[model samples]
Target: MSTTLASRASSTASRPPVTTVRVALAGCGTVGGALLDLLARHADDLTRRHALRFHVVRILARDASRPRSTAVERALLTTSVAEFLDTPADVVVEAIGGSCTADVLARGALAHGRALVTANKALLRTQGPALAAFGPRLRFEAAVGGGVPIVRLLREGLAGQGVHRVRAVLNGTTNYILSRIERGDPYAAALAAAQRAGFAEADPSRDLQGVDAADKLALLAWLAFGADPSTLEVVTEGLPRDVDAAVRGAARSGRRLRLVATAERAARGVTAHVSPALLHLDDPLAAAVDEENVIQVTSASSGTLTLRGRGAGGAATAAALLADLIHLFQPGTH
Candidate 1:
């Protein structure tokens, strides 16, 4: 019996034949550059563990001369979207943010029949359902929760669990700032610190205005409620004008201030909001300090499930992109 079991286990764990997945990457900034490093660092491990190898066939960058990772070969760089699309690739990973160029690239990739993976929540806020028309060919696991994998959890793991409510700390920048404020740092200092830490961008208007969280919440509403994200009118409220006072007050009351994005299904329809909310000390949302994200999902059957993880930075987003690539091109997935 032991010999038979050993044989079965060995067969199950045996490395399958390696499959090379060609990837056309757009943007070599933080997320894209991190992906290149990850690919190079894990080249051997990916093949050995999953029997898969990823080859970046083309890289679309605005300025090809910008200094980047040593793993990014200059030969693969292209400035023209047309030329980038012309490259033979199994997948196109879009890490270049914003709605304009990213939208163009996303539509172009799907039209060209190449699988698309993106971390562009802004674009998805307005065009998610349309891109999702391509079905499994489009994956945006990095759009909502950074490295938290909330998108996959809703799309795959809880597909039919009849999920009805989603509450999350979706904007890591704001969360980081708020956490700093809670720790006695002034709002400006907190924002500046977050910027220096790469948790906040130079122009963090979207994050500070609650637009970023609203965008992510819209995508989550779409996934959780089957609503069209483009049409969702989320009631958004940013950080308080007197944020320091609010944090001090909350702390005095044994509470924490967190920017919470929530969506719930009701008879009237799905209503969503992105605003700063106060939570008690023991609340899970309150524990999501700094750049950490916490998502609380409530479903009919699963009751309530919580997912928590680092929800900011390039490496986290890049890992989500890599996971999408593996899912799309894994030998037997199709």
Candidate 2:
């Protein structure tokens, strides 16, 4: 097996000259900017390892004049979607987020028969089926897990397995707040810390209200059980009003507070929810600290497969986006 694998790797590396994949990037914010840096820093390694080179042809940003990284060329920045879409490219990566403008870009990309990779869970939760109707050219490995690759696991690694349940810490902001609360920080202080660390936005209502986790859970349901994410109604409950008290209560009982997103497929139907739950210290979910996420998939064949990693931050999300690009355009992947 080792020899065969080595031979296959050698053959793949030796088979071709560099294949350049043109990319049209939407959004040059945190995730998009990090992607540009990743592309620039790892260009040679990506070519050597995968026989693939990435060339960004166009960039879509809200303010084209805003100063950006040196990796970005000023000439490629465009404020108009029409101009961005008109540029020729093999793949369109949408990291601007939200459902309105990002939705338009996603549709435009698929309309032109180009592959779409996005990190926007809100867009996917609402318009997943509509975009998926275009084809499998839609790839969103960054929509849920930041660096965890949970999407790939469900889509390919467990393709035919009987997946029954998915339990995860999908919202890093909530998890970080909870972890801090458990460690004796006040709720306000914990939230402030999360914001300072880039785990929470200044307006963190979506994360605090469980909307972010619910959106991610919906996408996970689509991947694991073939449910339409756009229509899956997740019963979501956010952080408790008296979260500090709840944390103290859980601690007294040797448990920790975690915002847990759960989806279970039953004979009757599928049920999903995002709410704060108490987990014993021994629980795998309890071991996740700060912005770390742990996703556990319970299936008939795979039993319980748990994946853990940094679940938030621009770099982690950017890396996932680049991973999707490599997966979609890598040699022999199709």
Candidate 3:
């Protein structure tokens, strides 16, 4: 019997091992649908190149009846968060953008010891420290700068280095609006164009009001400077009704109005904000146009590191999610 068992084990080892990682996706919106498409299209390459295979074991959506872009097995879809959390999965990706529900989903994932990746900046901005305290299995690269990988740079690359400041143009909707405005378009027309192109949500008040950028800046501040999100006073001022005037005025001055999100270590604590500022024509921030994002970090020794790339859209955001998934699955990284 022992000899027979040994021979069976050897036979099993001779065949290609079927290794699979289960993933629970808690949103089926644009970004989530893109991720599903990406996973299906790249599964073969991922298995061969990275020795990683992902099976989306469970999918959670607000409207389970709503049609999705990616064809998901109906048997795996669920509208109940409780059932979704109970499903067995190695990692949980939260693409839902809200504070209360996202916090609940993130906490559930961490409680089960599953790695959590999220694109919810509001939740991270306010509750990141508590979530990080729960464990080191939380990742949120898509929260700050879409597909820019800014979070990883600060967390891993500059782990030991003292990071002094982080500045970014983190909101793609506002960036698009600003870009159009710079091109001699009116604010209303630019905003309408952004909406038509799907860059801005139906109700883009959050983005235009600077709340989105403020949330991203708050999260970046906490990651780069160990600042408490609650303590960081983020002064947010969106594009005013006078934006048209400001844009024209800046053009005459050879400058442009770019919404800037900045965070710096202050004497008492960290200060962060999102507000429209006049940047010189040659300024790097001014050069970030048409949904592009640029993040600049100043460190004690590394000096300055700038990352620029597509900031939003389904493909870019989905790529960020894939990066987080790869990081979670990488050997010895967990």
Candidate 4:
């Protein structure tokens, strides 16, 4: 009579079981908060579609008292980095902005054999290869182009294809500013508009100075051509101190001024740069205005592939992070 256990399932059960990955997150700002909301809102759909679920174990934030989305549990919040690192989890999601936090999280997550995913291009541009050396469990689809899925396209979609050229408008803040300027606003007014619209950060130096696009381009080169971006010297250029005249001048010639990031594989190596250039009116890049990010890849086998999407804001970036999370954790999925 004691041999039969009521807790046991039937031997003939045929449905696939749901598997879960415990996730420890670092940062809960715009991107991180949105990520929490995304997980909560889509958890059921994910379980139905992928047969997987995420259990958030811990989160590291600068201030535990700060307000966050309703999806984030207060009991899981902590400020100590050590606690975050020590928390038992299958994956670590880092959305902290600065390079310092990114470096620390990447090193710690990889060392622990935990899958790592980040949306920090600045960190990836310099430390990606080193962190990735730990294993193939690293993913950063959110780093390159917000919700564009450019990284997945390079790594999985065109795995063996010979990619020769990659050119893109990778910064949405600068793009938004330029769009305002094209509409006859001065650089100051354009920047102010961007700030008011939440399109630009408070300190827009990195985005306005072209450093952000350079960082993204460097990462793109690493994935597309197997080049070490840290060692590659990317000749960088930003928008003119004032884009009013540049925008007006381009409109007169039926062209458009856009900050473009480019990379080309030469016989010697890969050459990459970020420059503000005038694109012909008919150019697809010219059509990407406001906060649009567009990339065109010319591959030997796949021909030319163009990918474009919303390149700014928390929602778009969070979507990318969710994709990477599923890619790494969903069993039997590539």
Candidate 5:
């Protein structure tokens, strides 16, 4: 036998076989359901290709009887946070939206030394550093840009790339509304359409008021510039009541109105903001229509790298979570 093959065989024989990793998922909403579907559909491939497999051991939800896509066993569902945390899990995935519950679940998972994967931008932006300091394995890849992999780009691919600025359109709900309005639909009608499409929440004030963008940009600022989310003075302004008029004015000026989220380093610190702005006809951001998100990163050595993709919906968020899961289970898989 070849020497390399002998070494591989010896290593495999000596090490204990890695069993399927147990995962406790919080929230069975859109993103959670999509994740369960993804895991179920690709379980065999994940094991064979990456030597990784996950079994959803427990599901945490306010209503244990709520319908979920995964058809989880009744015994695996729980309404109590304590019960969910007590389950033996190698990792915890939090798709819950609120800050209060998400914070507790995140802290509990970290206290138990379990790897945490979350899609909660609000919690991460508000308390990420503190929580990340407690656990060495916390990841929030799905928080910022859905499935765009911007977090991985900042944390790993561009670790030494000296990124200086990040400009993006991070809120897909607002983008969808604006696109529809630009196409002659009224803002209210557009917003209703977005909610119908599952791109906007029923309470879309967060997205329409630019809070969602602010939260996402705050997290990105922390990752890229080490700016504290609480300390950063983020100026935010949403689409004005006269957004349609602004879009028309921009069109007359050969421009388009886009909700822009920008983070730049200053001598004092990093400055971040989200607001409606005009993009020239040829600008890449101007072409980002509907629910698409585009991020442009300027690095010292790498210049500008822009990523564009679907920025909302369950499938995209679930895909980001899957990427994070693969990274955690098989660091060399990517």
Candidate 6:
């Protein structure tokens, strides 16, 4: 039964329409690459459910010649920052870590009034105020808690509550090393295992020196209590370069070793510090091990809220990055 085009028009006009969300991605490292894979793998489900389609319009990396097994079309890769910025995109995601180019990209994107998202704790720790000056178009959830939605919880869940303090176990590499030590492995052996599992970086100095966790703690204080990342003084103690002593002491005392970050609202201001401490057997943090994180927020109204999850790994971090991307396009997100 064939119908005229004019007669069939009314029947086909009621179908739903779809809109695509364009994204400009910077960096193709672990988190960035996994993000691409996630977006591609879930595109159809996301579109079918949320009416959102993510299209990575451009990617900025140091060396485009570097081999990658991502789904992104080769034509989208660019080594030129200028070209990456000039490309039209609804959002710019900076996952490249470091102070130089990544900061430049973040600043460029924000200055251009583009929606900016980042999974870079180091960059944010160094220039949070500068980047945030670009307004509410910026969102960063992965920078602090890997896959845990702690940032959103602070912003939305406890929007009106007065947070008095935040205590967290923020580094997965150290946690994994300490866990291994508790299991009878030597400190060096544990460190090697963490590296083999991809939890620790090639130069794990930052993670071991407590710099990485301290940076993440500062970011959390800023979000949860409105503290300034720059002015926030974080007293840091890298988990003893060798966890053997700490592990032995904890074992003797019947405690668990965990590097904890604390931020308290004091009359002077918020005081933040990161240190490796022995946790009692029943302490909430005692359960966190190998690539796991636990963040506890004590607020005036909300009492205490605890978030626990895998705190390391590209997949976990990429999930948080993807959430930020989708929320940028979600209705009433801001």
Candidates' RMSD to native: 5.8, 4.8, 4.8, 4.8, 4.9, 5.9
Task: Give the Cα lDDT of each candidate.
Answer: 0.87, 0.89, 0.83, 0.86, 0.85, 0.85
- Count clashing residue pairs per candidate: 0, 0, 0, 0, 0, 0
Q: What tens-digit string does per-residue lDDT give for candidate 3 at 198-262?
A: 66888999998999889888888888988887667899999877888888898899888888999
Residue-wise lDDT of candidate 5 within 1-334, one digit each (tens)?
Answer: 0000101111265443334678899987788888888899889887666666678999988887666554556688899999999998888999989899899999999888788999999898778899989755788889989878999999988887788899999999999988898899988899899998878988999998999999999998888988888667789998887877887788788888999999998787788889999898788888788988999999999999999998888889999999888777662432
Q: Estimate, for each residue in 1-334, the C-alpha lDDT of model 4 and write its tens digit.
A: 0111112222225645666778898988878888999999999998878767788899999988887778789999999888999998888999887888779888998888788899988898889899889888888999988889999999989888999999999998999999988877888988888777656778999999999999999998999999998988889989986678788888899899999999999999899999999999888888887888999999999899998888877889999999998887665774
* Model 2 residue 236 lDDT score: 96
TM-score of 4: 0.93
Cα lDDT, model 1, residue 63? 93
Runs of candidate 2 with Cα error greater than 4 angstroms are 1-15
Candidates in order, TM-scores: namely: 0.93, 0.93, 0.91, 0.93, 0.91, 0.92
65 in model 1: Cα distance from truth in Å? Answer: 2.4
Q: Locate the minimum summed-lDDT window of 10 residues in model 6.
A: 1-10
User: Poorest 10 consecutive residues of model 5 by lDDT?
Assistant: 1-10
Candidate 5 collision pairs: none
Candidate 6 error regions (>4 Å) = 1-17, 332-334
Range of the 10 consecutive residues with the lowest summed lDDT in candidate 4: 1-10
